[model samples]
Target: MTSRVLIAVTHLLGVGHLARAAALARGLAAAGNEVTLISGGAPAPLVAMDGVRLVQLPPVHIVGTAFSALLGSDGAPAGDTIMEERRRLMMEAVAGLRPDVVITELFPFGRRVLADEFLALAGAARALVPRAAILSSVRDVLVVPSKPGRLEEAHARLLALYDGVLVHGDAAVLPLERSWPVAAEIAPLLHYTGYIDDRPVTPAGEGADGAGEIVVSGGGSAASLPLFRAALGAARSVAGHRWRLLVGRGVPEEAFAALAGEAPAHMTVERARADFPALLARAALSVSQAGYNTVIDIVRARVRAVVVPFEAGRETEQRLRAESLAEAGVWPFAVVPEAGLSAQALAQAVTQTLARPLPPGAAIDRDGVAASVALVACFAQARCRRFPALSRALDEVAAGGGSVALWWRDDDAVAPTPALDRLLSLAAKHALPVAIAAIPAHATQALADRLAGEPLASVLVHGLSHANHAPEGEKKAEFGPHRPLAALCKDAAEGLRRAGETFGAPLLPVFVPPWNRVSDDLAAQLAACGFAGLSAAGKATRPDARRARGLAIAHTHIDPIDWHGGGGLLPLAEIDDRAALAVRARAAAGGEIVLGLLTHHLAQDEATWAFCDDLLAFLLDHPAVVRADARRLFREAGEEEAWCAA
Candidate 1:
């Protein structure tokens, strides 16, 4: 259950992306997973990195709002050398860790400039022996691209390479569709994980350092320099109030010193504080840009605030967030547009915000860190629900110079239906063979024609008429003991004859009993009736006696349908438990054991179909599991001579 997770995040302007990724890494690590966070941004001293493996690449950041151009650590254009080093380090981490899950933060959504490295990392993940689940991590809101086809390109890349996208905000509060144009196209893969607020809550009056003071912050970047300068001028005008300005580290030393020097006697300007959230707890009013993390802190503090969103260089993420929250009345704030922001406007907004009473705390989801951690963990495991256990067992078998054989069987096939098409498509998709049990009385030539095109599909006779012959008090079965021996044997021979006539070349000489139940006398006569093999549910019983009578047994061990309970698909955990037990038993027996997956195509719902598709693809992709078709399985079961003769 302990998965190894690798999170890749790069921040070009602000540290919000890195900060969110770090929080996620910590949450996963706390859940007993091995977490490695690779950051490709300028390091921020305030971001927590406890209980995580931190990998820093040659960092590159953009100056001001010039996102098209990247600057190296020396503040010059990032040349080929730095970009190459970054890509090399990224691929190295992916190769070295061989993670079970790879989370690319904001790629294929907002980081088109760094597509080369992200695409390469995704390719490496796909090439792993057991492929890693690739996921995209994005904030609640995004900057909608104005250029033609950019959104389409992101959508295409997501469909091609990603398994899921974690939207870190609650849909009820703010859905991705509010900002993303193609949200509907990728809706199936989006998981809304509340909001990622990991800051510890501090009680009111606890923040003595900022009690009754005006707090101003611009997040952890120099992009907030305009906001700081505006707030400085506003502080001089707004008298009789203690003011605190927190300058981010990304601001140049001279810029920070200038703000501090120009502060009035009532104001204090310093570097961004680690306890900003704590400061907000007691501050009378908060003045800051409407970044995701900042808004979360303000919401937790329940403080009346003024928001000056950073809208430079066509940046609309913060502006959209501020407007949405304000419109919903979720957080008490007044927005001061950055276009015409000045000392007078900021002072008026700050005074108005302080005048309003604190709005009652809105009931919104704020458990996003924990929710995201649980979601990612489940996403990683669910990508291959039963595969890890089966893979491990197969690994041990291979280590001991053994191997595993797997076969697929779907019952209740009468004619060519959409369900049958889906089953056949799954088989062809993985190039794995499937044994379809068709009722001979109802089997049609159309079904045979369909199978002719699908070489991997073969037909097995599923009883004479698939009509229950058992007494009403007992379980339903077609070939139960209530029937006479001669009558049952005659029906068996007739069923095989009908199946052979219907499906000439694709027919396998196998008997599949309805409800997997047949009388002992009837089972004993299958080989004599030219069955060559008996297919049933559960493990093969009386193998020696059947083999002496020249009848091979290939029993299906896994069934995903809950026929006895509601007739819907069983929970994935139950199916995985069954599979784990089967695989472990096979490994312990120390031989090439064939594990069969049983399904009912006609009875399958969307959930069942999806599960079967994933299961089949996983078994086919595994290196140690051999896909055994019906003919091959029966031949391996000591019916080679019978198959050859037929």
Candidate 2:
């Protein structure tokens, strides 16, 4: 379905709001939705998009009581001329184009710069368009207002105007209440979408260019002067390695005046330019202000930094952000507070940062972005389903020693044809029910048709898709630095969803990633996607329900050998021994041990069936041993239901 989206962005105090909106626009556009970025104030150059249209009004600025007339760098004050022109254009565009969705950024909650304009836009959109979905995009953190009641008023305005609020963070991690004191009432309008961003970290190769141990100095050409001077003064004392400083907007004019004279012969200082990540990737160390966006890039690029947090007085956004980042282990390198950006202080911090080894990098859940995309796609499809809520009972048929199921070859397998009687006899005795590993395109619909309404152990849509093997050490398609990985996963998810509709079961969102191998980045990506759980390589940490893939998976450990397997079967003796050890391990753990199963119908033999009997005998003797559905165990354990109710 095509969607017409209008995104309004205002950056009164910082660029976060605008930046996030830009990222959302990219995602929306990539999904083939028409997106228009409406600028109410100056936004960063980084938020530009290809397919999305950029519409700008004559920019306005806030100055004391009401807004002062804004100028286009001419310095002369222009009256209602610009405002009238912009208002006329804006209403005309809204009435004429009539967008399907109007997303206002930060006005109702954070930015009051363009509150009037956005409110006008909203009124115009509703009166003319009638069917537009009104949304407000906000950051995870909201600065606590000095006068306690201001936020409540702002939130009320938001509640009155916007249909929904898209918060780009998890409520479990940083709940709205943490920032806004009155979060309970606001909960109804909130939609916690994981952070949406497209900026790529600089590749490791770029940092190696222009050798001589480098350091970067950047803070909007206005505040960087002191750091530059301090860095220059420090270079005079530090000997050995040559120092090259990439000066940002902060350097004082005089700091560069004596760069040649103040610095040792080997050290070089140059004026700042963009492409900071590239320099950071190569730099030995950096002494910089703690801007949230820059800090993320610094951590991603693996640069050792001495954080001289910009102190906006009692407003400690930068200071708090830097401290929290270090605590999170992002910048393990070091931190130098705002007051300590002086010559000796900066030089000392720089020396320490350079001497110290770079911090162990943050694991990227390559699957995080992909899984999030898939989750959104699922939500979109669910949105379209239009069916009133419905529930179906789960079927269960127990066998001896807990539960056991087996299956023999079906027509899809490349095997000899079996007569009806022989197949029925074997299936009746050995395979209690069906367990099909439904591979998409080649597998799902077939399994659904073959076993429609039949009792089955489980029918799983495996790993989004079966196409395996990836470059850059990623064994799963859902994870990797692959171009547009989100798009790929979303497509695959759509396919799996169709399979679920056909089978009428949960259809297993469990990710049997082609190879049991998954990179940390991939795992994190899946967690953000709202996957119920991921049956991947490691244990998952759960705060509430479950963590999916690697990051979102609730209770990480479980396997029944009932998972995907090759045609090869374990010898009877080996299977017995493996089961024996598994039994002992479960007894030791004292509760229940989950073992993933790998059943292959194509390779069913007497030896395999016999091994199952032996394991059953052992399981029966150990009264503590329990058989569990991996999905069920995960859900029950993740929500901490027993503990929470108490």
Candidate 3:
């Protein structure tokens, strides 16, 4: 089918995102979809290919996911004019060349300004294009949300607007739950298209003699010179092992030009190269920072190495990423806070890393890529199949008449652009009480003012200041009063009080953390602060699902459209739209038919929103279907049958 595809790319800085978009473009073309690569960040040097087309949008640099109304060359802002120009270019580009499928790179998954363009395109596609597939093609792992206040909620709005959220990370290496929020709800819509970089090579075929001993690397740019130097010094300090350092694109030649000649004979430094995966396949060991790209290379290479997490301000992205890999036993790793790192520490980490056994590089759910691809192909073909993926999702959402309280992260930072309308409407549709967390005083108060009359509107304690977690570690043991916990209890309460007093709406008793990874004392802490409830999800690691056991973390579960790495979106194979066909099959088997839907109010994208409307549209596509909200659902829900032991 000749479907017009608008492939959007918004890497903001790194080239990894554009690289993945280039790869996915390969598949969309093979499947005969008319794919256009919409350029957002630094324009990728064109890779010429037929069927795949490129349309450049004026590029804009994002400071930390928020649109920097200015560009930056050395991490410093350009002029505001640069941002305005990019915005104008994007709108003009979308308005002129209408597409059948507007495939966003990271808007809902990460970049959101594109979402504004997407909504406009979605409307045009729905009206004139008719069969346009609104899709989001994403790499695995979103830099874990670091926004302080409403910025979190602003992101979730992006996810609710898309048709399909295409995840490029293979679940074989990582589960979506390890990193993202509302993973279960987003699981069904997720696709693991494999790590979209470096094809695999067998070590048996390639001689190890030709390759070096161990490979150390930092991804593209933004390399931590201190971290890299420390790692190199550590390797050099060790006497015997052979090592090659892959300096990232971010590193300047001036920084390491002398390292090659000055280095201990055992260590060599080279510019960042693409064949690192090939190097990994033959190496005895590896060392690298935990950029998602680097992590994938090491995993795919299946080499055992020590990871030294980057020590930078609020970089929960690489720190948590490395820790997750370590927890999964992929490597023996260590972290160096940028504030206090040394060459000796790195050298010690390298020495120890060499001794550890290579973890069974994360298990790949073999068919996650195929499953994710199939969902996209089905949409590409515009085939309405049964949603077993959707049905199986509902299987876990126990039918209940209990009061279904809902929770989601919000920063009120992205500015209340019209981007939030559909999501708010959905909450309204369900009569769900929406909770915004981690909001700034003025932002939340303004939000309360804007939402004054809405019965569902309310604010909760999120954070005092919505900055990234202090690098020391912010993940509280479940219920612990940690950084955001205490900050939130103090500030969010004040913000709510100020807003409630001014706007006349009652504030809520929930303490919602920015990322929902609250510490152990948070619940008891919140209760002490007079909080009546707590809401968070995708973390099955927390204790007491029942508030009766502890104030419930959440009653109305959040459905995160897992697009980041294998974190939010499920292994696509697990999703079976065929289960919707099972509705027919369920009738035949005399079984109950229940359909489930979940959303992470954070990290929502254009395709996710479209997919939702499509799913509901599909549900409503036919007559004789009823969509019920959980309000008073426990009363109608069947009770668990118990048998007395005789």
> 370-434 in candidate 3: lDDT tens per residue?
45445666675552433544443333332321111223333333224454555567556444444
Model 3 spans with C-alpha error above 4 angstroms? 44-51, 62-81, 84-98, 112-128, 143-160, 169-174, 183-194, 202-210, 256-266, 329-340, 357-362, 366-371, 383-646
Q: Could you give candidate 2's per-residue lDDT for residues 574-609 as a string of tens digits? A: 343443343333333333334333444444543344
TM per candidate comes to 0.65, 0.51, 0.55
| Candidate 3: 10-residue stretch with minimal lDDT | 637-646
Cα displacement (Å) at residue 169, model 1: 0.3
Model 1 over residues 200-221: C-alpha lDDT tens digits?
A: 8988794478899999999888
Best by TM-score: 1
Candidate structures ordered by lDDT, highest first: 1, 3, 2
Error of 3 at 497 (Å): 49
- Of the candidates shown, which would achieve the greatest lDDT relative to the real structure? 1
| Backbone clash numbers for all candidates listed | 0, 41, 82
Worst 10 residues of 1 by lDDT: 539-548
Candidate 1: segments with Cα more than 4 A from true spot: 384-617, 621-626, 629-646
